[model samples]
Target: MKQNVWLYIGEKIIMFVLSIFILSLIVFYMARLAPGDPLVSYYGDRAEKMSTEEKARTMERLGLDQPIYKQYGIWFKNALQGEFGLSYKYKEDVIQVINKRAENTIWLGGVSFLLIFLFALVLGSFCALRENTILDQIICKLGTISSCIPPFWMALLLILIFSVNLGFFPSSGAYDIGKANSFKSRVSHLILPLTVMVVSHVWYYAYMIRNKCLEEIRQDYILLAKAKGLYVHEIMWKYCLKNIMPTYISAMAISVPHILGGTYIIEMVFSYPGLGTLSFESAKYHDYNLLMILCLITGIIVISCNTLGQIINERIDPRIQVSEVSRYGK
Candidate 1:
C-alpha cells in the first residue's frame, strides 16, 4: 500500500512537470510566431524610426534575430536558472511587474471564491429544503438566468448603473488615486467586480449542491431518519447536508480555475489592474518574457488545482484509488 502511494505521488509530479513543459513550449512558440514586432514593445516608437541596419542590431540585441527554437531554448535555460528576464513594455523585471499586481488578483479572487461557496451553500440548502415550492422555483430560475449572462456584460451593466448613471462607485481600478491605503476606497472599487464574479459563478455550484442535497434526502437512510420522527429541516440540516460535505469540498477544489477565470474576465472588463489586466497588456504588446511567466503561473495554478481535486476525491472515496490501482496494475 505504501509503495502504491509513493508511485502515485511520483506519477503526479512527473505529470505536473510534463504539463508545465508542454504549456511553456506551446506559448513560447505561438508568441514568437505571431505577427508582431516585439521590438516595438521594448523600444516603443523608436522601433519605427530606426534604419534597417539599426533595426537588425536592435533585434539582435533583444535576441529576436535567433531561430524560434533557439529563442525558446535560451528562455527555458534561463527560466530553469530562476531568471525569467524583463518585461519589454514595462522595462522592469517580469517577476517584479507580476509581484506588483499579484496581490490585487489574490485579494479579489480569494474573497470572491469564499463568497461564492458560502452563498452557494446557503442558496442550495434553501432551495433543497423548500424543494419544488414557489421559493425554490424562483431561486432556480433566477440563478439559471444570472449564470447564463456573460460576465463581461454583467460587469458593463453594473458599471453603467452604479458607476456612470448614478455615480455610486468608481468605474475602474482597485482604489482611488490617493486612497491606495484606504479601506473604504478599496471596498468601493471592489464592489462591482466582486458582484459580477459571485453572480456569474455562484449558481452553477449552488445548483450542484442543491441536486446533491436532494439525492441525499432521497436515500434510504434519510427515509429511516424520517420514520424516526425527525422533522424535514432536522433531517436536512443534520443528516443530508452533513453527508454531502465531502462532495462540496471536492467541488470547491475543482472550481478554483473556474473562479479564477471569471476573476480574470472581470478584471479585464473593469480595468482592475490585476494579473488579468497585466496578462492582456503583455500579450497585446508582445511582451514575451512577461507573457511567458504569466501563462506559466496560470497554468501551474490550474493544473495544481485539478490534481488536488482528484486527490481529494480519491481520498474521500477510497474506491476511486482502488479502481485506479487495479486498472493501472500499480
Candidate 2:
C-alpha cells in the first residue's frame, strides 16, 4: 500500500513536470513562429522607424536574433532560476505585471467557482428530489438554455440590461479606480460579470449532480433504505447526496479550466483587468514573454487541478486505486 502511494505520487509528479515542459515548448515555438514584430511590443512606434542595422542590433540586444531553439534553451534556463523575463508590452517583469492583475482574476474566478458548485449542489439536489415535477422541468429547461448561450454574449446582454439600462451595476472593471480596497465597490463591479458566470455554468453542473443523485436513488442500498421506511428527502440528504460527493468534487476539479476560460472571456468583454485581459493584450501584441508566462500559469493550473481530481477520486474509491496499481503492476 505504501509502495502504491509512493508510486502514485511519483507518477503524478513526472506527469505534471512533463506536461509543463511540453506546454512551454509549444508556446515558445508557436509564439516565435507567429507573424508579428515582437520588437514593436517592446519599442512601440520607434521599432518601425529603426533602420535595418539598428533593428538587427536591437534584436541582438534582446537575444531575438538567436535561433528559436537557442532562445528556448536560454528561456528555460532563466525560468529555472525564477526569471520569466520582462513583458514587452508592459515594459516590466512579467511576474510583476501578472501580480498587479492576478488578484482581480483570483477574486472573480474564485468567487464564481465557489458560487457555481454551491448553487450546482443545491439546484441539482433539489431537482433530483423533485424529479418530473413542474418546477424541476422548468429549471431543467432554463438551465439548458442558459448553458447553451455563449458566455461573451451573455456578458454583453447582462451589461446592457443591468449596467446600461437599469444603471445598477458597473459594466467594466473589478472596482472603481482607487477603490481597490473597498469591498462594496468590488462587489458592485463584480455583479454583472458574476451573474454571467453563474448563469452560464451553474446548470450544466447542476444537471450532472441531479443525474448522479437520481442514479444513487435507484441503487440497491437506496431501495433497501426506502424499504426501511426512510423518507425520500431523508434518503437523498443522508445517502444519495453523500454518495455523489466524491464524484462532485472530481467534477469541480476538472471544471477549473472551463470556468477559468469563461472568466477570461467575461473579463475581456467587460474590460476587466485580469489575466484574461492581459493574455489577450500579450497575444495581440506578440509579447512573447508575457504570453508564455500566462499560458504556463493557465496550463499549470489546469493540469494540476485535473491531476488533483484524479487523485481525489482514487482516494475516495479504493477500488480505483487498486485497479490503477494492478494495471501498472505496482
Candidate 3:
C-alpha cells in the first residue's frame, strides 16, 4: 500500500512536469511567431519609423534579437525559478495577476460544476426512466436541441429572457458594486451566470447518464434482481444506478474539463470576474503571456481530469484493462 501511494505521487509529479514542459514549448514556439517583433507588436505603427539602433535597443530589452531557441532556453530556465517574464498589458509580475484570476475562476467553476452535476444526475435519471413516454421524448428532444446551441449564444438568450424581458436578474456581471464582498450579494449576482452554467451542462450529463443507466438496467444482474421480486424502483436505484455509478463518474470526469472550457464563453458574455474572461480579453488584445498561461491551465485541467478518470475507472472496474495488445503486427 505504501509503495503504491509513493508510486502514485511520483507519477503525478512526472505528469505535472511533462505537462509543464510540453505547454512551455508550445507557448514559446507560438510566441516566436507573433507576426512581427515583440517590440513591434507592442508599438504598432511606431515600430515602422524606428531607427535601426532604436530597434536593436528595443529588441535587446525583450531579448528578441537573440536566436529563437536560445531565447527559449533562457526563458525556460528562468521559468524554473518562478519567472514568467512580464505581462504586456498589466506591466506587473504575471504570476500575481494569474494567481488572483485563477482563484476567482476556480471558485466559479467549483460552484457551477457542483450544481450542474447534481442537477444533471437527477434530471437525467428522470428522463431515462421515462424513456419511450411522451415526457421522455419531449425532454430528449429538448436536451438534444439545447446541446447543439453554442454556450455564448445561450448566454445571450439567457440575458435577454431573464434580465431584459423578465427583469428578474442582473443583465451581466458577477456582483453588485456596493455589496461586492457579501455572500448574499454574490449569490444574487451568481444566479444569472449560474443559470447559463446549468443550461450548458445539463443536457450532456443527462443524456450520458440516462444512456448509461438504461444500459445497466438491461444487464443480466439487473434482470436477475428483478426476477427475484425486486420492485422496479429498487432495481433501478439500488441495482442499476449503483452499478453504473463508476461510469457516471467517468462521464463527470470527461465533463469537468468541458465545464472549465465552457466558462470561457459564458464568463465573457457576462463580463464575469473569472479566468475565462481574462483569457478572452488576453486573446483579443494579443496578450500572449496571459493567453498562453490560461491556455496551459486549460490543458492541465483537461489532462489531469482524464488521468484521474482513468484511475477511478481502474478502481471501479479492475477487469477493464487500460492497455490492450495491438492486433496488427508486421
Clashes (candidate 1): 0
lDDT tens per residue, model 3, 1-330: 566557666877798779878887887687667564455446767888999999998879877788878988887788678777776666767677787677657667888899888888888788767878999999988878877888788888888998899988887666687665688777776787777788777888888888888888778987898889988777788777887788888878877778887776777888887788877666655666666677777887888888888778766774654231121111
Q: Is candidate 1 or candidate 3 better by TM-score?
A: 1
State the lDDT at 248 in candidate 3: 83
lDDT of 2 by residue, 109-208 (tens): 9999999999999999999999999999999999999999998888888888888999989899889989999999999989889999999999999999
Query: Count of backbone clashes for each model?
Result: 0, 0, 0
Q: How accurate is candidate 3 locally (lDDT)?
A: 0.76
**Against the true structure, what is each candidate's TM-score?**
0.97, 0.96, 0.85
Listed per candidate, the RMSD to the true structure in angstroms reads 1.3, 1.4, 4.0
Flag regions of model 1 displaced more than 4 Å. 327-330
Ranking by TM-score: 1, 2, 3
Off by over 4 Å in 3: 1-16, 36-55, 322-330
Better of 2 and 3 by lDDT: 2
Give one digit per residue, the lDDT tens place, for model 1 in 1-330: 787778888999999999999999999999998998988999899888989999998889889899999999999999999999989999999999999999899989999999999999999988999999999999999999999999999999999999999999998999999888898989999999999999999999999999999999999999998999999999988998898999899999899999989889999999999999999999999999999999999999999999999998988897997897796576
State, as a TM-score between 0 and 1, how close model 3 is to the true structure. Answer: 0.85
